[model samples]
Target: MSKPSKSNLKYKICSLLSLFFMLFFLFPSFIHADTSLQGYKEVFQDSPIIPFLNKKESSKENNKEQYQRLEDVKVVPGGQSIGVQLETKGVLVVGHHQVKVSEGAKSPGEAAKINVGDTIVEINGQKINHMTDIKPIVDNSGKENKKLQIKLKRGDKMIETSLQPIFDKKEKAYKIGLYIRDTAAGIGTMTFYDPKSGRYGALGHVISDMDTKKPIDIKQGSIIHSSVTAIEKGDNGLPGEKQASFQTQEKRIGNITKNTDYGIFGILEKEVNHEKYEEAFPVALSHEVKEGPAKILTVVDGEKIEEFDIEIISSVPQKSASTKGMVIQITDPRLLELTGGIVQGMSGSPIIQNGKIIGAVTHVFVNDPTSGYGVHIEWMLEDAGIIKPESNQNAA
Candidate 1:
C-alpha cells in the first residue's frame, strides 16, 4: 500500500473517470425528465444486442388503424398458362430412399421410374415412408447390391421401375441416388394454366429435399391437384402447415412462375377478377400507398370472401415483386380473435389501398400471426411476363 504499482494507479484513475462520466450523463435526466418511450427507445437502440429493436418499435406505432381496407381481390386478365397441381388428400416426404427393380432391371432411376424430385409414396406393394418402415429393406438390401423392382408415384403419373445399387469403395456402403421426404410441408395455390413448354412449378419457392433441405429439381415434376382438407394457423413458435388431397382431375391455370419469398406464382389460366367483387377498385402503385388505413380481401372459414381493416406501414419508391410496403395490423377483433393475424391459405389475399389493388399477403410472422409479409401486385404482374413495365419519371 505504501508504493502503488503503475498498473494499479492507472486502474483507479480509470474507475474514477468512469464514475464521473456516469454521473455526468445521469445529471441531465435529473435536470430534464426523460419520457418512458424515450427511455425505451434509448435502451433499445443503445444496447449492443437487439438488432431489430428499432424495426419492431417502428412497427408497434405504425400498424393500428380502423376501416383501412378489405375491399376486393380481383384476378388480372390475359394470363394463359394452364399450370395446375394434382390434388392430393395427403403426401409423405422423406429422404435417402431405396426402391425395387422390376423383372428385368432398368437403369437405376428408370427401374424405379423415379424422377430426381419425385416424392416416393410406395415400394413393392408396400407404402414406404419413414425410416422404421424400411428397416427390414435396409437390412435385407445390405446383403447385396442386386437389382430390385418398385412402384412409384410422380405427382399425377404413377409408374414402375427397376433399381440396382453400387458400393462406394470410400464409404464401404451401397448407394442409390434415391432421396425421399416423409411429410410435405408448405402452402400451395391452385392455378388453371398448364403449358407444354416443359415449364411448370409450384410453391414458388422450390420444395426442399427433406434429407438435405435443399431445393428439389422442378423440371421433373408433374402437376397434381392438391385439395385443401385442413389448414393450421401460422403463429409464433409454430408455422402452420397446409394439407391437401391429391386428386386426378387435371384442372389448372397458367405457366409456373419462379418461386419467390412472397410464395409461388404461375401464369394465370383464369384471372381472379378484383373488379367484379364488391367495392372493387383500381390497383395502386407503391408510391401511392398511404399509411393511414386499408383492407384485405380474403376467404376465411370457407366463406370465400371477408373484409378486415389494417394500417399501411410503409411503401417503396420503385416497382418490385415484393414492392407493396406496409406493416399492416388487423383492426378487426373478429379477424384477430378468430384467426390471429394472417393465416396460411391467406397467402394470395389481395390488399386494396385507396381504390387500387396494391399487394398480396405472402407470409405470417411465426411469432406474431397478425404481422406478416406482403408482395406487391406489380411483382406478380411482372412475373407473368405479361404486364408491361411502367414508364419511368423521365418518360412521364
Candidate 2:
C-alpha cells in the first residue's frame, strides 16, 4: 500500500492512547463491583442482586418477602435471671507475671512473644482446655529441660512459638510468667427463647475479659437458674447492680454455643417458666419499633419475673447488627423505686412493645438512671443463628 499520511498515523496513535487511559480508570471500578458481588453472595444470598439488576419485578418481590418474614417471627420473651459460666476455647492469657529465676526477674511468656490477649490452644501438641492442662506440660518440660512448643490464637491468626520455661526459685515451680484464665462467670437476664427450637439469647452484649477487654472465644458455657438476693439501686453518675446467686451444683438451664457482639446464644435444656409470660409473642424488627410506651420483663424481687412499664424514648431502625437500637426509660413507679432503673444484671431483660418483643435492655445510663440503651431483638436472633433472614425464600 502507499505510504500513509502523517495526519492519519497521528490520528491512529491518539485514538489508541485515549482507549488505554479510559480502561485504566475504569478497571478499578470493575474490580470493586466484582468484589461487592462476591460479598453479596456470601452475606445476602436470599436477596439476589443479579435479579434486581436485570428485572425490577424481582426486586419488589424480594423486598415484600423480607418484610413478611419479619412480621411472622415468634419468640418467647425471657426475663428470668440466670447465672452464666463461660469456658474459653483455650487458656486465655490475661496478664504477665514476673518470675523470680536464678538469673533475675523475667517473664518467659513475654520473651516468647506471647501477648496478654493470646489464647493458648496447644502446648507440645496437646490440646489445652483449662489452666490445669498447661501446668502438667510446663512442669514436665522444665524438669526435663526441654523447650516447650506453644500454639496460640491471637485475633484471627494462629501462631506457634518455642520457649524454655523459667525455673522460679522462690515458687519452686516452672513458670511461664503468664496469668491465664479458662472460665468466666457472671449473672445476666435471659432476653428471649424460641420455644419451638429451645434456642435462647441473653446478655444483649458481648462478654469481654476483665483484664484484656476483648471478647472471649467461647469453647463451651452454661446458664443456671439464679435468684436475686439484693439490689444496689442506681443514681446519677453511678450504675446500680443486682446481686444474685445460684447453687454451684444446680442443674444448667442452657448450653452456650456462641458469643458475639450482640450477645450469648445457646440451646435451653428445659422450658423456662414465667407466670405472666407463658405465651410466645411475635417479634418486631428494628424498623417496626416505635418511640412510645413499652414494657420490660425483669426480676426485681427474689426469683419472680414481673412486667414493668417503660418508654422507648427513641427507636433506631438499623440495617445491620448493632448494640444500641433504642433508648429506653423506666416509667413504672414500682420499677423506678425498686432498682432505680436498669441495673447490671438486667442487661438482657426483654423489652416488649405492642404485645410484641422489640428489644432487650443493654446498658444503663450513667448520668440518667431512668434511661439506657437497648438492642433490637432481631439482631440478637440473627447472631444466635435462630432466624436466618438471608435464607428466607420469597413467598410463592
What is residue 143's positional error in candidate 2, in angstroms?
1.7
lDDT string, candidate 2, 368-395, tens digits: 9999999998878877666675532211
Candidate 1 lDDT over 1-396, as tens digits, reads: 589999999999999999999999998887565465566666655543222223445535533331122122233321111123321221233334433333422234434445654555555456664535544554356466555555655557676666666444455555554554443333344211112111222222234554555444332223333345555656676766444455433543233334444335543332232222533245555566667788776544422345678776766655444433556666777777666677655556667677666666666777877776666655554443324444222111
Q: What is candidate 2's TM-score against the reference?
A: 0.80
Best candidate according to lDDT: 2
Cα distance off (Å), candidate 1, residue 23: 99
Q: lDDT per model, in order?
A: 0.48, 0.85
Model 2 residue 62 CA deviation in Å: 28
Q: After aligning candidate 1 to the native by TM-score, how far in Å is the CA of 275 from where it should be?
A: 11
